[model samples]
Target: MPRPIVLGVVGDSGAGKTTLTRGLIRVLGDEHVARLNADDYHRYDRRMRREMGITPLHPECNHLDILTQHLLHLRRGEPVLKPVYDHRDGTLRAPAYLRPARFLCVEGLLSFHTETLRSAHDVRVFLAPPEDLRRGWKVTRDCTRRQYTTDEVLRELDRREADAIAYIAPQRAYADLIVTFTASRTDDPSHLDADVLLRDSLEHPDLTPLLEVDHGGVALVRRGRDLLLRIPGDLTAAQVTGLEESVWDRMSFASHLRARRLGEFTVGTSLRRSNSLAIVQLIVLYHLVTARATVALGGDPVRSEWSAGVAPEPT
Candidate 1:
């Protein structure tokens, strides 16, 4: 049997973790991917957190040990009764059964809080969007989906900022890839540009060929200790298709990656596609496919710690 490949995605509230995870699911197919949200391990519900003056972002509010044990179970291809946290009313639902699949995507604010859990992942990603954009995303999401007013969302953001800095932001240092999405034009969140920091520690497939062939919108540069790929939102659909095709060409054995329309997010009742997002998804998918290949060839893909970072910055 092929071992499962786990990808740990950590980020603060309103970061693009869910968006990225959703795209990977679309590409890999739901049946072949198992999804787990670390937020479900919260020890207290919404009212309890408020009464105790504790935000859900803190470690005390969560069951970190149980979460680590569950991660280990999943890594060993076992089923776990994962807790479910209902975001609609900030309550806990009944536990749900989760079976391991070819790929496991564990995403939440504290997915990498412990060494044991971090060691189980084949890839660790951190989403670090600009504060203003993240705030906008939070406000919009809370208002539309969670029944919160704009003011209430802003207040909650202020309350969580401290926990975010102390507990959440520190996880970036352990991520193999740091993904940041910023506005392409001033005051325009619709067209966002992506800056992906590929750390030196991991053995990543070279994307230089795509950058060279499509130099108009995609550019690669070195930043401190990581390689940064800037993906502009202005790229036309044809340009995006070409880059996606180039990536697919290199991984022809990854038949599941033939799907192009993946990870579409809703914006005020409409779905949208991002050129930058597409590239990021393709690169991540490449890693997962190659890791699986390594296992098929009787090699250990999880031999090294692809989690630690070395002063990665956006160029």
Candidate 2:
């Protein structure tokens, strides 16, 4: 078996990392993908963090060296006894034994903080929703799911802001792709626009032909050495189908994997779909399966013009 393809999805808390990862896992099949949340590596529990005046966003709050070792092991097709962090009550739980599958999806706050940690993955994606939007998301998720009161979540956000700037924001410079989802004109959560910055670090599917079509509001623009692809949320059914088919046509080799809908998300127990989200997920899916194919052929999965010497501008 080819070694498992590792994918790192790094973002600040409530930046839609889980939503994006969940969609990919659904398409990739849960059984074939080993999931790891980097939050499990927290060095201190919630109460300890409060007492120490430290936040999880800071590197010192995480067992990063151990996390790096486990990531390296997974890349080499090894099993790990991964730690579990219970978010509901903000406590550390017993470690869980995890075996590597065909792909490893690691999502968390600081997965890409160090070079060794970054190099363990075939794909690195960063979520960078607008500050206001992310705050709203955090409030909603923490209040409803994590048992955090609105006031507590807001206070925590304020406390973490400094560390977010110093530590979390800088990781965007290292990602192959930066994804931002913003509210549309009507402020509908389900119909948010997606702006994807495709960095030169990875070879992405060519979307130039789709740009020529007058399909709703989809666009691909070149920005310096990178490409920015925008997908509007309110696309017509026909337009959405055309764009999806164009990408699906290119990755026909992996056609058998498209058994479920791509952009299904929930807003307070109400399930919704977004054309923009679907398109973003499809593009990511393209890279993942493409990388898997390259690895199976005994070739390096990444083909890049990116250099460590060139520091990317913060997105």
Candidates' C-alpha lDDT: 0.83, 0.90
Mind giving the per-residue lDDT tens digits that candidate 1 earns over 12-44?
998988888898898888999999999999999
Kindly give the stretch of ten consecutive residues in candidate 2 with the minimal lDDT sum.
302-311
Leading candidate by lDDT: 2
Window of ten residues with lowest summed lDDT in model 1? 303-312
Q: For residues 184-277, what per-residue lDDT tens digits would candidate 2 score against the true structure?
A: 8878887898899999888888888997889897888999889999888788889999999999999999999878888989999899887888
Supply candidate 1's per-residue lDDT for 119.
Answer: 80
